[model samples]
Target chain A: MNRDALSAGLVLLLMAVQVTFVNRLPLPGDAAPDLVLLAVVGYALARGARAGAVMGFTAGLFGDLLPPAAHEMGQYALVLCLVGFVAGRWAESRPEAGLAVALGCAALGPVVAVVVGVVFGGAEAGVVALTGGLLPVMLYNVLAAPPMVWAATRVVRGRDRSRVRSRERGARRAGRLAGGRP
Target chain B: MKDTRQARATVGLLLASALVLMTVDHRSGENSPLGPLRGAGTAVFGAVEQAGASVARPVVRFFEAVAAAPEAQRRIEELRGENERLRYALAAQALDHRRSAELHRLLGTAGLGGYEVVPAQVIARRNVPGFEEAVELDVGSADGVRPEMTVLNGDGLVGRVVQVGPSTSTAALISAPASSVGARLEGSGEIGVVRGAGENGRLLHFRLLDSATPITRGQRIVSFGSQRGVPYVAGVPIGVVERVEATPGELTRIAYARPYADLTALNVVGVVVRPPARNPRDAVLPPAGQNGAGR
Candidate 1:
């Protein structure tokens, strides 16, 4: 319960920073890293599938409700939820495979978001967005995933880091998966 | 890890709810039932975003300055030469009428297009990639920012106020796929609609009302404004024509133009609460080829 609360608070902060700070940066590309997605992937790797899914949902809901919302209320929530769940499965089974999963999930997120926008919103606008925004954002997220993923796991699953570092295979608890490159 | 079925159920449930919520919001259309909810969220999050923005501004500015170092270096060299020549000219003649005129234009209180504007800093930005681009401003309804008030930077039209909270409000960018503005050709006065060219936000599609009006690559476009200037104010620079599309048999000719304001890098902007008494026409526009890289 305490872990869940900590992760939730962290995600909320990530969402706030993403909207206010990250998006405002004069980055090279038109898009910024989806910090919420990165946090979700990281938290999932640390906390397992159920907690990951719930975390993703909460984070996505925050993204939906936060100000300057251009998309519909539930659009991002659905995408993040799925990313969290699959990332959790990787955590549960192959805990050492953290960085790869984070990269894969982060890359997959924008594509899913584009699909969701087309299905739930307008097809024409979705096509236009995918063509223009998808590549740069995908690349940005993937590049950012490694460091952000490591940081999230460290922040959310602090106690477990020592255990993972000591290479205690199979001694890991639920909601505390080893993250990053083995 | 062992509770696989339960975890799957939770995922399924959350995904389902999100889908339902999206569908309800989408179906509600213009007058969304979630309007109040959105407003409430804005009120709550606006304060948080403002606080966060204040804390983050210095950090962001540092990175921006670093990222722009090369350009800034080049600019410094150019300015040094210009400064040397300016000092020589100033000594030659203490009369500085041309310089004063430039300073007056830069420092004037009368905003672009003569609108009474409330200056606001962007506290948060929500960019939905190719579909939507919106930003939350620090000043809001408390600052007399009503919904539909025109938001512009010195460069040109940014967007318009959409949702106003007590201390903050959101404005969609002119580059948003959903945004379309009424625009007029600089000299011809032939009106048309300029729609956001989605995705990269590098260009806008202007469809001339009359296909035979002959809009060339170097033509300029300005806001036609709206009734009482509710959404857009008159004569604000929109963009300069970049390329005219060949629509051989179409009634309206199409051209793509680059927006004056750098939509990708927005900071301080003004929201026009009161539009000019008379249309400024081409006066608000930056002299052709100065900011207008039309051709």
Candidate 2:
């Protein structure tokens, strides 16, 4: 019930939805909105640099596995890590961090994704493919981010406080157990 | 503080790994180690996906059932009529079977020819939008499939196998931009090279053997088979001529043909094993008539 476990479960849930359901939505050329990126960005904004970086890597790894054509493994992980780091840093600077972080990350997410895709996927990448396939996808993800963030906020705000308390109790119990062992 | 540095180092390592993967992929043209890792990732993701689908299936089924109610009723009525028609067709087929048996008996044929048909289910689709003209089929080298073999559905030609792997083969549909087939007009006997024009149809560029003989619209075109080295079989129905035009006093006529098979609705297809011999020399025209043509 700890934050890390909850985040991990959410990440898997989002990735599964992304691959099986969201991708099947009658989007242009089978393009799906990047739900994993949104989750990473949201977590980064809520937490800080270290958390963002870790979550981003996990999400990117999941994204890399979603497509058969995504033969390049760590490319997504790298790009998403950078995305989370930047967003996390930006979130620290802003007063109304949640919405601003979500919007900003949404805007920048697609550019990073396309650049990484082209660099790894090869030279056969066409303008039409980028514009039609990747661009619309980015736009869709950006549009989808706010609602998902709001929903996550509701779930996290309700469950996270209790989860954090339970984790603290467990940590204290572990500390006592370790102290008594020797 | 050290943890922050470790996190940065991890990110750096990931980036470096990505770059190395890209380099390896570019140089080798092979699926990198990343691909298998990604596949494993997908498998995990796929499980969650399946779980989500299982949760949502009843809702989807309800909606589908509601939507299909009227259509289902109409379909039942239509099926009743179709059953009557099919019964008549079946009777006719029985009569034709008797005649066919009599002819075969006169020819001293005892049994039906031995032919094996294997059914393959499409597992993955990899149609690169606007660039490549092929999709990968799950059946591959494991299924006795090889490159350059002709693929056909119940209607007509689908495409040819281009890349084969242990478990998968990429079949380039005829509608792809890179696809080229040699075809000859069924009526006029004009030979031409049919190339996919990156559209729903193909562009037939005819080689004018004699400038005097002009091709008209609505002419039937069939595969001209292989030339000296080009790979394709003869007598495969390519398409019918939709439009033809003389290129403003040019020697040859340019025509567009719609492929006989519906390229998009492809599900099951048969791969023709033997190559058909319908070379340019095999065209009914004499060598004198074939001279000066460049197809």
Candidate 3:
């Protein structure tokens, strides 16, 4: 399969992981890591803003559309889209900005999400929720970032190679069609 | 420079679309356009989850047992102490068994009544992002499961089926903020309403209908069977009163009931397919029937 399909499949697989195991694990503080968010941040950081934003939108839409998604639809989508953009633009200078960048994105993503959820969806928001739910979740996301970032970077690298190969193949086809010497 | 412009446009477009979808979803009611998509996701994912749970159950149990060892040890010790006290009680209980058995035989006709139950396994669980609780079950409309059916574990009432797919159903647990059930004080037969207090708290809040009714802690609570028994079936255990809080300046008092069924640890449960038989004998507290008085 092509890079886009593979990446999408993998992201969906990560979502399944979030639902099946991550949510169920007896983690302290009832904070489950947002696996999909971590994946989005890593993929976006590796691929640049446009790819990241698109991936974020798609992944967030699926997150909203999927079952067990209790909140109002598109809330996560909006949160992640903005998060993807923020991560992409901030880390633009160096797409593969490593662990610190990934961790920062992990921390910021949920904060942005919680803010947007409260502001737009009128969700419950208070100091307790922030300290109790958001912070711990961010920490959990940070714990999950290393492997997630590594896998995301690999997906991005594979896509880069595929794009390059396809471009070269098109160029060769055009050259042959133009009588070889033009 | 050019990449920046493209990135800006992409983010703006996607973010705008997301906002639009969110607004539409919020405004739409049961007919929300995303309902089918959500159901499709649930049906597919529920199957995969159930399969995965079966495969992972052993692994999960190993870890659970490892984590639970200390607690288990403490509980064993506690049970040992309780056992010794219960030994004397058991001897006294044996003397009453004949009378109790006769009572049970009579109550058996009146107790549990005509409710036909269907057993189901919990396939998946998702706390609706901290505000609500829901679970996907292996049985659905196909298994005679329907919306509003009362669900229970062996211990007590769990919740009610809120949505049904072809092969999977979603149950809105009693823990959900919007959920409320008619409950009865087992000893006095006094009725009250048990309402969920939201995710911030674990216990359910109940208020008595009459302020004059005296309530005490540790009183057993059971379902005050509803008409036609859609949301809850009568005679199903709900909880035990943990504490009674008198509302300041108000005549009524509130009691916190700890549910008998461990909602967090639900694995297998039963759904009542039919309501219990309504009879004249049901009106009699400690229902009197042909065999003897009910327990």
Task: Mark the regions of model 1 whose C-alpha exceeds 4 Å error after superposition.
Answer: A48-50, A89-97, A126-131, A159-182, B1-8, B26-33, B77-114, B187-191, B207-213, B246-254, B277-295
Name the fnat for model 1: 0.70
- Summed over model 3, clashes come to 0
Q: In candidate 1, how many Å is residue B31 off?
A: 6.2
Instruction: Give the TM-score of chain A, superposed on the true chain A, for all candidates in the order listed.
Output: 0.83, 0.76, 0.82
What are the candidates' individual DockQ scores? 0.52, 0.19, 0.27
Clashing pairs for model 1 are A47-A175
lDDT of 1 by residue, A1-182 (tens): 67778778878887888888888888776788888899999888887788789889898888888888767888788888988999988767776777888999889887777666556645345334566677888999999999999898887767554332225533554325455335
- 1 or 2, which is superior by TM-score? 1
After the best TM-score superposition of candidate 2, give how far the Cα of residue A26 lies from its true spot, in angstroms.
4.5
Models ranked on DockQ = 1, 3, 2
- Residue A17 in candidate 1 has what lDDT? 89
Q: What tens digits encode model 3's per-residue C-alpha lDDT throughout B1-295? A: 8989988988888988888887777789578897777778767766676676676567657766887888998999999999999999999999998898888887676455555789998766664333445666788778999878999887788899866777777787775544678888877888888765433224666778878888998888877765677777666777788978866667677887777777766778889887656642345332323211111
> Which candidate gets the maximum lDDT versus the true structure?
1
- lDDT for each residue of candidate 1 in B1-295, tens digit (9 for 90 to 100): 3499999999999999998888888789668988888889989999999999999999999998999888998899999999999999978666677677788888884354355789999988877565467899999888998988999888888899888899999998888766789999999989999877765567787889998888899888988876677798776788899988888989999888999888888899999888666554545443455323322
Misplaced by over 4 Å in model 3 are A93-98, A109-135, A161-182, B23-28, B71-115, B127-133, B154-157, B174-261, B277-295
TM-scores, each model vs. reference? 0.79, 0.55, 0.70
Instruction: Give me the candidate number with maximum TM-score.
Output: 1
As for model 1, its CA RMSD to the true structure in angstroms is 6.1
